[model samples]
Target chain A: MSILKIDGVSKRYANHTALDNVSFSIPAGCIFGLLGPNGAGKTSLIRIITQITGADEGEIYFRGERLKPDHIKEMGYLPEERGLYKKMKVGEQLLYLAQLKGLSKAEATARIKTWIDRFEIREWLGKNIEDLSKGMQQKVQFIATVLHEPSLIILDEPFSGFDPINANLIKDEILRLRDNGATIIFSTHRMESVEELCDHISLINRSKKVLDGPVREIKDAYKTDTFQIIGNGHLMITSPDFEVLEQHENHGVFRANVRILNQAKPNDLLRYLIDRVEVHSFVELVPSINDIFIRKVKETHHA
Target chain B: MRKIWLIIQREYLTRVRKKSFIIMTLLTPLLLAAFMILPGLLMTMSGDEETVMVLDESGLFEGKLEDKKDLKFVPIAGSLEQAKTLYQETDYTALLYIPKISIEDPKGITVYGKKNTSLQTQMRLENALEKEIENQRFMASGLDRETLDKIEANVKLNTINLSSEGEKDNNAMITSAAGVVAAIIIYFFIFLYGVQIMRGVIEEKTNRIVEVIISSVKPFQLMMGKIIGIAAVGLTQFLLWIVLSFVAVTAVSAAFGIDAAPTPMEQLEAGRVAAEGKSVDVINEEKGEATQAEADEFANTIQDVTQSFANLPLLLILGCFLFYFLGGYLLYGSLFGAIGAAVDNETDTQQFMMPITIPLVISFIMSYSVVLKNPDGPVAFWMSIIPFTSPIVMMVRVPFGVPAWELLLSMALLVLGFIFTTWLAARIYRVGILMYGKKINYKELSKWLFYRV
Candidate 1:
């Protein structure tokens, strides 16, 4: 069953539409990728889901119930804009924020200690946030966001300011959170992360959702009947129905890229190509999620 | 309630632990003592004397003025023009030219000192001339000079105020002490706690901690905790200061001959007695004897003067101070909290703080109004009962007695005023905490107050 739902949500800022007829849902436990370019309304939808901002139209349900003010108690939101009290001590700030999310002092302390030990930040607990580097502060904030074990965790650009190792650590933690039955809404521009971790994906463009589905299903739906043939020859596109888009010679082998006509299958195209060129290799190109995302966004732009 | 207590605890602990707070608490008493006693110490150290050359031209009042210890009067044998010129050449400090005066009208006599002598010197010269004229009149009237001199004596008055219980004490000293205590208490607490609110707000806002804090706790709780915690801190500091002041005064007094230390009233009485004793000794040494009637007259004058002071009503003064200090702090501390919440930056606070501060200043300036009118009169009654003016007006009424009911009513009203203002301030704080960027004005503030919970 869906744990969180956004039904026909639309938001507008004066004359500009920020989110247009957006509808989506997250099932019980999965890493959901919210992918978009700049100004793509990803942040807007994330804000709506987290309840930081209200949607101009539509309703959000948490745990199959209408979302209310108190529902935020179960939602942990780490906004893109870094917010932490720079003058406060590391451990004190984390515990305070945890308590605000409804954790008892002893519970907050235990959770904070576990996270601090995991992140190797125990030495920095007594130090002021200002004394730490930006990455260290981000780590503290991330720990604060997740310390209460909220049911729905929304992390916006969580890996923005980290080195590769720390980024991987956070990535591992995100997966760990999802594995432990928490619904995660991860928003980012990093398509590679989407390829590795996302079970479901949503792509929004110009204040509208252009594409969304399970990562595998969306990739399959956009797959074209094109062939990647690595061989010695390129077939001439003599038929009006078929065409060769481009050709390149790679290390004593000719690689041809082509798109077939409608009603034609990849097997048929391969049968035709085998007779003309040395069939060193023939493979159908299944579009990666990134390619599908770019193509669909560009298609929407043109439409 | 628990969260508010936590907030209060943190604010109190953090502030009290600061070095600045400790330093300020200790430094204030030292500064106050310096202001009170520095002038007297400087005067004693200087101990300078003035020399005067008296030129009497008419020869009618010769050898009239006596040379005193601090002022040395010399009778010069020279004309007025010569004496004035001779002073420019010689180091004669000041030349006083007293023309021979008609015994019928003493106003005809003139006094001249080169380059404007001091007021003290001028008064001394004028007094000497008057005495000389009187002596001349006494002799011409066929009065026995020795007998009249024997009879003349300075009388000092002593006062005793008998309460309903028949307890006698000096009222003037009590009133002065009460007024000073009240003014100092109100001034110190208002300043100390008011700035704590400012610093507390700035710390939260500057560190961006207020965002998280306000999300869970109501702005009212946060602001209330801070104001109360800081007030508690101020009260603690006040108690400590009183203890320190007493210890310091005692230590210094002991170091400089404790035997010489007398209660303030006793010191005043000793001053009167010493003056009388010195005058009598001087007269007895000069005239060879003084009769019985002269001493009795001197004693009567001293008794009467002391009696006026001792009869003053002091209980009223002490009560007035207690009412005013608590009232004034509540009225001002609420404003200070409001100011704290209205602005995001410290620089922006200045614009919003003026209206609240001006009334406090006006109340202090018009404090004397309470003293001049009836202490329980309509004007003093209204000003003291009103929250804004009570702190200062109540102190001014302490010197004059006030009715019990009026005092109790004013105290109750001021307490109610603080509660209402604090509630209003909490409203502003709630909206102001989340509001960033735009400058807040009366219109915006009113809208914030009217916003739905």
Candidate 2:
């Protein structure tokens, strides 16, 4: 079931269009990636979901109900520009943010204590945010975002400033939150992380949704039914069933990449290849999310 | 509402706990006390005790000079050169040489001091010689000393303002002084604390924390929270200053032994009584004495002066002060906050601040000249009614007893003004707070005001 459903949302600034007829949904208890190039209306859509600014011409439904001010309590947002009161003590600032998200003082204190311990940042509680290192401040901001335990969390560029170790830590925490039945919507330019973590994604280009689905399905839809074979094989015959895109011979082994035409299944291609060569290995190659993102965005741009 | 309260609490607590706030709150009263009392203390402490040798070579002015406070004159039985040498030898402050041929024109008489004497001392010496010469002329003219004294008696006027209600004695000096003081305090509070609200907004905006906070609360709530929080800080400081300055002034006055001096009002009343008693004595000369009646009349005048002070609407002034103080702060503070949001930095704020501050500056200047000179004049009356200048101008007219209808009208307009500005500011603020990196001008700001939330 989708936790958030944005229906035909649109936003416009004075001289420019920010979002245009954008529609997408994020399933519950899953990580959803919002992919787009710079200024492609991803931030605008996220702001609509968060209700920082109202949609110019659309509706957003949160948990099967029209989004209202009270629904903000159920959503957590970590904007791209990470900010906390620099002059405020870390623990106090976190508590304030948590309380603002509708947590009682006692609950906020307890939750903040748990988060500080989980993040191993107890030493930073008394220090002002200005004194913290950039990576450490990011960690605090992350903690502030999730401390309220919202069912849906939106993180914009969640790992931009993190070192590898801290990035891994945040990735683990995001997966952990997802596993605990919290839905996450994160926007990032990092395609590698999207492939590694996101279950579903909606790729937007120029304020329009170009591609969207589960990660596996999106890759499958973008695939060309190509297959790679490593065997003592030399397929010299031309047939309507397959086309050899590339072939190479090294030492005693033949390597060939072939694309199947005529809607042939993998088994049929294997059968055809087996008769022509002694097959040692057979595998189907699928496109990476990065390639799909680039190709789809380029396709939309050209269109 | 709860979120707004939280924001307000955070804003108020964080600022109130700052070291700068604490230092300013504690230091301002001492500075004000020093400004009000230190000079008088120093003047009294520097007692002027100096003697001058007088060479009366004209011989007609023999035994004419008299001794005065902190100043003494001694006849030198020698020439001018000898008097100068005596002045140099002794601790005399100066040598007063009266030439023998200069009785007809006293300009030739000179005071030769080691350094330039104070204007007060010089004036005193000149007054004494002028009085002696006048007396000599009067004697030569065969005029009685009594007639000369009578002609020299000063005339004092007692101005009483009469209204349909009754006759009210108006003390122009006290009322104007009080009006100016009230105006200054209002001006200081509004300017100091209004800028504080703007800086607070700028800090939040520049730090990029406003985005985070506004996610959970509306931009209007955030603005109101900050503006109200800073106003609370201003009032806290103002009240503390009043209490502390009162204590400080009292302590300083007691330490300097200045509390024993008669207040200006008491001195004025005493002068009137003295003038009255002189006339009464002249009238009762044939009937021997009228000391009992004179004493009774002097007591009655003192009672009347005290009653006038009692009749002043001090409570009304204080109540209006607080009302206008908060009203004015809210009106200006919201505008300042809006300006803070529209600009990326302090430099860009200059263009926006001029329109908001011009009225305040105008009112401050007018408070001194127009309002104080004529509290009931049309210029003062209208300024006190207009919302922009009313906070200060009305305060300048408050101690002079503004009419109930005018005060009510000004207050109604001020409340309406605050509401209007807050509505306008919140519109701009809601849009501007989220805007960044663009060089926003007045046109852009106006556009932001109409932008859909």
Candidate 3:
């Protein structure tokens, strides 16, 4: 079931078009990646989804109902520009934010304590945000974003300020939230994380969605019939049916990477390569999400 | 609505807990008390007496000039040159040389000293010489001194305002002073607390927390919450100042063995009565006795002046003060908040702040000058009626007794003005808060006002 469906939503500033007929949906319990480069209308679309801005045209649905003010209580947003009241104590500020998200004070306190304990930041609760390190502040902000246990959480560039260890900690938490039936929409230019964590994604470029699908489906759609083979022998004959992309000697054996041409299947390429070389290993290469993202964005840029 | 309430609570609690807020709140009343009482205390502490040497070559001023506790005049029989030489040698503050001139032309008298004599001293000496010359002329004309003294009696006119209700004693001096004080307090609160709203808005915007907060609350709600929260802070500070100042004044007055400290109006009236007492003393000296009836009349006049404040609509003044204080703050606070949203930093706010500040400043200046001088004048009436200046100018007129219809009209217009500014400001704020890195101008702000929510 789709938790959020943005239908032809558009937003325009005075001198620029921020979002142009952008449309996408996030399924329940799925980690949806909002992928875009800088100035690609990703933040604008996220802002529209968060209701920080009103869409100029079209509608957004939350759980098959039109988005309303009360819907904000169920949605959590952590913007790319991380901010907290500098002079406010960590615990007090988190409680205030949680209450603002429609949690009762007791509920907010209990949840905040649980999150603080889990994040191992129990000692820093009484300290002001200004006294915390950037990574620590990020942890506090993340906790604030999810403190109310919002059903649909949106985190924009959540891992930008985190070190590797803390980033993995947050990643684990995100997956845990997903497993517990919380839908997540995270927007970032980091495609590596998308491949690792996101089940679904919509790549937006220049106010339009250029590519969107499940991670496995998108990788499959962008796959070329290419095969990498490592063997002891090399083929001397070159056929127009297959092109040798590269060949090198590794571990006293020949390894060749080849691309199948014109309607040829991976199996056919493997059989052709096996006939020429002692086929010790055969594997088809799939394009990384990073490569797909760059190529798709560049393709849309040129188009 | 609950989210807005939460925002207001957060805003109010954080600010009220701040060290700066606590310090300022506690410090202002002490400073105000010091300002009110220190000058009078210093005057009483400085008890140095001044001696004046009077050289009457014509001897016409013999025994004419009297000596007071602080000022002593000693008669010196010497030539003009001798008096000048003696003045330098003696400890006299000033030497009065009465040149042997005729009573008709008493213009050549010179007051010589190391430094220039104070204006009060100069006026006192001139008044004494003029009285003596008039007496000498009157006696020479064969008119009895008693009849002349009676003819020169000073008439005190007690002004009373007559209306359909009845005649009420009116003291213009007291009313004007009270009106200006009220106007000034309103002006200070509006400016001070209005800027606080602006700074608070700017802090949220600059820190980039506005988006996170506004995602749960509308921009209008956020602005209203902040403006009202800070206004509450202003009210808390004002109430504390009033109570603390009252306590401090009472304590200081009690410690000094003085009566409860008088209002500014009572103080002014007391000074007038003291001046009149000096003339009364002069009259008693000449007669070699003081009349009981005359003393009773003088005491009654002081009582009347002090009681004049009782006739003033103090409760009404206080109610209107609070209304206008909040009204004026809301009107300007919204504009200040809009400016805060439109600008990236404080420096860029200067241009936008001008249109809002000019009217406030104009109202403050006019409250002191035009409104105080002629509370019933057309300028005062119009300024009091105009919503922009009414908060201040109307408070200046309130103590002077404005008509009910005009007061009601000003109150209605101020409410309308507040609503209008809030609507306009919210429009700009909704768009401006989300906008960044743009050098916004009046044109851009106007465009923002027309943007669809």
DockQ for every model comes to: 0.21, 0.71, 0.67
Please report the candidate that would top TM-score against the real structure: 2
Candidate 3 per-residue lDDT over residues B194-304, each given as its tens digit: 888888888888888888998888889899999988888888888888888778776666576433346454455554665455444433342222354465455455666
Kindly indicate the candidate among 1 and 2 with the higher TM-score: 2
lDDT of each candidate versus the true structure: 0.71, 0.83, 0.84
lDDT of 1: 0.71
Candidate 3 at A160: error in angstroms?
1.7
List of chain A TM-scores, every candidate: 0.87, 0.90, 0.92
Report the TM-score of the second chain of model 1 against its true counterpart. Answer: 0.66
Residue B426, model 2, lDDT: 95
Q: Chain A alone, model 1, TM-score?
A: 0.87
Ten-residue region with minimum lDDT total, candidate 2 chain A: A232-241
TM-score sort, best first: 2, 3, 1
Clash pairs, candidate 3, are none
- Looking at chain B only, the TM-scores across the models are 0.66, 0.80, 0.73
lDDT of 1 at B70: 55
The list of candidate 3 runs beyond 4 A from truth reads A230-241, A248-255, A261-283, A294-303, B48-152, B258-304
DockQ winner among the candidates?
2
